[model samples]
Structures are given as structure tokens and as C-alpha cells.
Target: MKLFFILFFLLVLSVVPAYSYLDPGAGSMLAQLIMGGVAGLVVLFKLYWGKFKSLFVKTDSTTPEKDNSSQTE
Candidate 1:
């Protein structure tokens, strides 16, 4: 672990910046990718909203209660 950290520090300290140009098209593509991923997640959440909501919600009994008030003596 120590040797790994030493090597990582040396690499980071010796790293040189590459003169790169980020074109507008590449930036727009990256933005679209981020937005699409977010929109996809939103749609998935909307589709399974009921199931996701049920995870934290409590349910009452499914059986109906008997009404004794209508019983004859």
C-alpha cells in the first residue's frame, strides 16, 4: 500500500498537461449524453413509481371484517 501510494504521488507530480482543444461538438455531445441519462432515469422512476412507493408504505389487512351489528339474536 505504501509503495502504491508513493508511485501514485510520483506519477501525479510528474504528469504533464496535454495541449488539447475541446470542440463545441464534443461538448454538446457530452451534455446530451448527461441529459439523456437523466431523462431515462426519470422515465424509469415514473414507470415503477407505484412499486417504488410501496416499498416504504404499510399495507392494511386484505380480508374484510365481519359485521356483527346485522346479526339476529
Candidate 2:
């Protein structure tokens, strides 16, 4: 594993940098993709917010009530 990582590191370091131009349309598309992801996450959370809250809240009535009368006695 160490040898593999060393080889991989050397391989990555040997790569030449590429000079590329990013057009305005590419930037706009990237921004739209990020915003779309954020919007989708917000909508998803809104839809599941109630279910998420229910995970921590105990609403079931099946459990028996604790005996509090003995405490008073």
C-alpha cells in the first residue's frame, strides 16, 4: 500500500498543467448547477422535515404510564 501510494503520488506530480480557457457560458452553467443542487436540497428538506422531527419525538401511546402514586406516599 505504501509503495502504491508513492507511485501514485509520483504519477500525479509528473503531469503537465494544461492551459485552458473557460467561456462565460461555462461559468453560468456551473453556477446554475450549484444553485439547482441547493434548491433541490431545500425542497427535499422541506418535504421530509416533519418525518425528521418525528424521529426524535415519542408520540406513541402503547407504553404503560409510570407509577407516580408511590412517590407521593
Candidate 3:
């Protein structure tokens, strides 16, 4: 295992040669996609905020003793 790891490390370190080019249009498209995803998440949360809040909240009916005091006996 040590020999294999050493060889792999050497192999990874020995190679380096390549210039990459990115067009301006591609960068703008990537930015738009990121912004759109964030906007969609915001809209989704707004639509489901009530349901999300309910997950962490305890309703009075779940524990009947609290409401029992309010009723006439």
C-alpha cells in the first residue's frame, strides 16, 4: 500500500502542461444559473414558510391540559 501511494503521488506530481480559455458568455451564463437557483429557493421558502414553521412549533391541541383550563367545567 505504501509503494502504491508513493507511486501515485509521484505520478500526480510529474505532469503539468495546459492552458485553458473561458469565454465571457460562459461566465455570464454560469452567474445567471446560480442567481436563478437562489431566487427559486427564496420563492419556495416563501411559499412553504408556514409549513416549515409548523415543524418546529408545538400546537396547543397536542397537549390537551392547556386548553382544558379555558373551557367551562
Supply the global lDDT for candidate 1: 0.48
All models, RMSD in angstroms: 24.6, 24.2, 23.9
The ten-residue window of minimal lDDT in model 2 covers 64-73
Worst 10 residues of 3 by lDDT: 15-24
Query: How do the residues 1-73 of candidate 1 rate in per-residue lDDT, one tens digit apiece?
Result: 6545634664576454543233336546644543567564455345357556767987652332324323421
Error of 1 at 52 (Å): 34
Error of 3 at 26 (Å): 1.0
Cα lDDT of model 2 by residue, 1-73, tens digit: 6545634664575464543233336546644543567564455445357556867998763343335433433
- Candidate 3 per-residue lDDT over residues 10-30, each given as its tens digit: 458636343223333654664
Clashing pairs in 3: none
Reference-based TM-score of each model:
0.23, 0.23, 0.23
Q: Which residue pairs in model 2 clash with each other? A: none
Which residue runs does candidate 3 get wrong by more than 4 Å? 1-20, 38-73
TM-score of 2: 0.23
Task: Supply candidate 1's per-residue lDDT for 23.
Answer: 35
